[model samples]
Target: MTSAAIIPSTDLDRPELRRPMTDPFGRTIDYLRVSITDRCDFRCVYCMAEDMTFLPRADLLSLEELDRLCSAFIAKGVRKLRLTGGEPLVRRNMMSLVRSLSRHLKSGALDELTLTTNGSQLARFAAELADCGVRRINVSLDTLDPAEFRRITRWGELDRVLAGIDAALAAGLAIKINTVALKGTNEDEIPSLMRWAHGLGMGLTLIEVMPLGEIGEGRIDQYVPLSLIRARLAANYTLTDLPDSTGGPARYVRIEETGGRLGFITPLTHNFCESCNRVRITCTGTIHTCLGHEDASDLRRPLRASADDALLSAAIDRAIGTKPKGHDFIIDRRHNRPSVSRHMSVTGG
Candidate 1:
């Protein structure tokens, strides 16, 4: 497949627009994860460096541009739209984007409009998000301990985040807690965290530390395979594998003890690339076809070149055509570098 940047402006001008986006591997690309900003309030140790350099605000697409780009995707059969960020709520006027995108949900073009947030600003924005038609959201919370939370996030306030979660729950939003299982840090707290989330009627998902970016430390030390977590859980409770997918790379299981659902995202021990039906777009309007690959298509130029989406749509199509069947993610024991150099926050997750 060719790069969309090199494609002529006049290419793909056919009247038959809005084709269902399907990759060469026959996976229907229906989910789009868009990063509104690369700036976060707290610098998580596993996600980014403590003193990190972020993209300038000028490099990020404006709210209007994001709306148009997302609309183009919805026109092409993207049923789900998720807005993400280093911390999406930290962005000024971020709710404007959410409120605008809720139009798709109202029109029935989009099945769901949601967000993956760190829950720092959810206390202030939870009501607005629910008013804008966000029924469910994913909050990334690794540990429930306040001191450990401070150690992990570096700048996050545990009480503030908990208050935000309470506000979201009070707003009637279905919440899913995403925890990254760290070997020595939060591994011991996994069971307690799971029980806390399930006890509150929120689903908890444990994710393996992926080799994605240089977080100024060795991922080998932080990595904890979900297989091991499942094994440990089996010693005390029964875990029944369940066929459940939330349009992402997670396998679900029913814990008979808690009578609640649990999810595991094992990118290193087991990959879900074969069933990947989503792609991510950065704040700078670059479309990454796969999270593990460096190859990307520039949609900003086409998006800014013309108001019409003909060139932008063609670029998206070309990018999807190049989607690899699987990704190569390995955490090197000897190296501090990652297999994929880009940070997970850059790719919106």
Candidate 2:
């Protein structure tokens, strides 16, 4: 029941420790995104294909294995940890993991622990998560219109998501609304969504759609750049630049009258490779150096074979060293990576 003990820099910089993970670009790797499970309840068109296949349970990493991997990353100087999913809460043992991470937070082994979910199952776990130590929660909510909600999710109800949002807010969790702006779909609802987020005192981020694995053919048509969305927002209100503490790529702005903030994640329009300090691990323990290029090292094999942190750190060092200067998809529209073939869900969006 103690406050966040906060991991100290001294422990990570011990003399006997392995060399810190620094890429060729001189970026210090400290952020880790862990995808606990690949199974998601809702089928969002922009994220997963309508007809999708999930990983078998046997292939998924066990809780103990996940704990070992996480500990190894923390030992290597990772400060911020984000638990993502196809929808993390859908996994039965997610809360136990959350509680364990909460212990790590209280013990100064981890700094910040957060989660990103579709919010379909949030109402049931919001209070427990916040009480345990999850301070930040990002919910992917595209539209407020019930009919559009159903259309985008294929079979989701808007009220349920709104209730989940309310539940998270009630639990005193810092909520950020993540909306994917599509040309014909939720583009027009941007302002409305902003007002809604502002009304609830939450920040909103508008993400421009990218052509990720099997997001289905019309990416060229569906793509809506932030430049256009920013213009629409500026026309209605004055925006002042607001830098974020979270080293994420989203460019944040404060609205004029309401004093609310808006975050724009323009992966296509702008790439944040120079400051990219994060690495992702799939549920099965594959370390993906970059989100765009799928070249990954099967970390599970090494973890299962050995428990030595020094050895684990060496394997991770090799993966971090391989990070490309930047993702090519931003420049090359049809860019394809031979190394990565799975969708964002499997990659842990």
Candidate 3:
């Protein structure tokens, strides 16, 4: 949380460390999630409380600053970039950033460009996004039951999200539906949700509810493990394992003879930290090497002070150097998960 700048005296002439940050399992972390804003239009029960506060716009990073930081990161071996937010589309001129990032794709500097959204504004921006070279999207759709959707999100317009999903698909964007699995809330609706997504040619990723800060307290009692979800799916339909696609954290499986795939992200019950090659940059410009750790490196100060390439590179190196071998949440065997001061909206889910 400190704002002081730490400048390194090293020069940029040193040999570039292009080596992939691989784990014991040989899984490399090449993905980076950058949160553009902490503000969201919906108030999901598991992400925020009814009275949560928002960060001031003045504190958030400007588009130019984000582009510079992104360029620095790309120069440092980060190949894939994911734009996230309380809702990334909520940020002004988001398409402009997309367009700027698209320029990198032409040079093969960025391999993949994606975004995660709550889908309230997705319909309005899908075409512009596709035109800007965004190829993939991940929409968080917890339930199809309109009443349940409204109840869970507090103020989400379900129809709007559905329309957005349709728009994105119409625009030729590869889409995925991200659903957080809770024991009593929408667990029973998994099959229905999967069928819906599959019907639309979109993959469905079922995420195990995680204890991410105080908001997690409301979900602790409702956590649903992967084993239970798999069992439930098995009872309803036959599943086939997709061959040669087991590298990522999500276990990809598909219903027999179905077009859509099912993914499971079991962070709470099954720790995937050993294969975590991804890091997160919050909207406030803090770099989080691990999702479950308290450690973070501030990048805003140096970035704002017109630091030279050497200093910027050194800062990135220091942040990655401090990246823990793995998060200690599971190793510590703690039952009560700590409450994260920054909400997921701000942290980019």
In model 2, what is the error at residue 95, expressed in angstroms?
Answer: 0.5
Tens-digit per-residue lDDT, 1-349, candidate 3? 1112222222222456334454344556578899998878888888877677788899999876787777677766678899998889888776666777776688786898889999999888988888867899999999999999998899998999999999999999999999999778999998889998998899999987655656635455667787898998898788888763423468788787566799888776776666577888988889987776777898888777664665566677678777776653331225554434456776666
Q: After superposition, how far is residue 137 of candidate 3 from its true place, in Å?
A: 0.4
- Total backbone collisions, model 1: 0
Q: Would you give me the overall lDDT of model 3?
A: 0.77
Q: Could you give the candidate ranking by TM-score, starting with the highest?
A: 1, 2, 3
Whose TM-score is higher: candidate 1's or candidate 3's? 1
Regions more than 4 Å wrong, model 2: 1-19, 330-340
- How large is the C-alpha RMSD of every model relative to the true structure? 5.5, 3.9, 5.4
* All candidates: TM-score: 0.95, 0.91, 0.89
Number of clashes in model 2?
0
lDDT for each of the candidates?
A: 0.88, 0.81, 0.77
lDDT of 2 by residue, 164-261 (tens): 98999999999999999988998989998999899889999999876666655456667788899899888988999976746667888999877799
Flag clash pairs in model 1. none
